[model samples]
Target: GGDGAEEEQWSQPGNDLSLPAVNQTKGKCCFSLCPGIKIPKVMDFLPNILTINDSSLPQARTRCLENGIGYREKCFYFVEDEAEWNRSETFCRSLGAHLATIDTWQELRFLLRYGGSLHYWIGLRREGSAPWTWFNGSLFNNSFQIRGRGQCAFVNGDGISSDWCSLMKYSVCSHPQTRPTGSRRDPEVWNLT
Candidate 1:
């Protein structure tokens, strides 16, 4: 007989598999599939997902107070109306803002959770043959594949994906939330600056 004690992979009759158990401490957990078999901790295999620190950036200051939510140095607004990508950009500009540019999984998750099931046109686009870039000049780089519908980027539950720029969809906007402080009637006394 060859190697006699080689472990085999099999599933139990009614067990549902799940991710490796995690705890409050970012340390190892005794994850085991069988009576005597054990696998290494989740942190050892995937440090990026398991051990990212909270953002240190300050909260965003948005111009509008009605529908903006602050998160990690930016205020986000979800435009409920469905419109083409260009139209969405114009709408955001009208509000003194730009389409929301997602910078982290936390922001992405926040949008998805509140966006319902509608695909949202974000600020990512490709210029002719150039790579996808945000309207705010940030580069769009991620593990998600940027193929298939290869022109515009939209956000959904699965993740960001490229789509036809002409397709109408809801959009997210970001901008400074700060408003000018002054009395409306006293125009001459109010400092426009």
Candidate 2:
């Protein structure tokens, strides 16, 4: 009868018992009915399928060039034999860009698959006792992605080990939009200014 009652309650049409909603009550309903079975929300699931190719690369590159900051969508591969970290950072800055920001496992995998040998630095670094921070000084809250021991971070070509930032290494940069010379603002900011 309890099982039937629980099922009936869950099946109620107007009930929006999402995981987030259910979690708020400390799993009171879950423990009572389905003990030991974890019910995850749709958002909690990781995507199993993803499309990766060269066609999207150009669009990403163009967007990075247009915006001065990295846009996350455009993942670039760098030549480890060609440039060092400082050189890479300078090169990216010259083109109105900065080191890549690794926010997702998908992005990390893509970077490692594309970026060949000679580890490249990512934009994340630890600041004081606080957690890691992106190059833009944003706090990193997502812990689902893997991280290495190095204080300065780099994504490996094989996507396994982390490398030092100061060491001479190749890197990929992402720019959000092309920065305007005189104003130091992107078109979006200019409009608002």
Model 1 agreement with the true structure over 1-193: per-residue lDDT tens digits: 1322233322223322223333223222234343322334332433322222212212233234578777766788889899999999999998778888877778888877877677888898987778778997777786455545568888877777778899889999987545222101222112112
Per-residue accuracy of model 2 over 55-147 as CA lDDT, tens digit each: 212122334333232335553535344465556767767655677876667766677776656577766666444577777789867653436
Clashing pairs in 1: 61-176, 61-177, 62-176, 62-177, 62-178, 63-176, 63-177
TM-score of each model, in listed order:
0.55, 0.47
Instruction: Quote the lDDT for 154 in model 1.
Output: 83
Stretches off by above 4 angstroms in model 2 are 1-72, 75-87, 144-147, 158-161, 177-193
Q: Which candidate is the best by TM-score?
A: 1
Global lDDT of each candidate? 0.63, 0.49
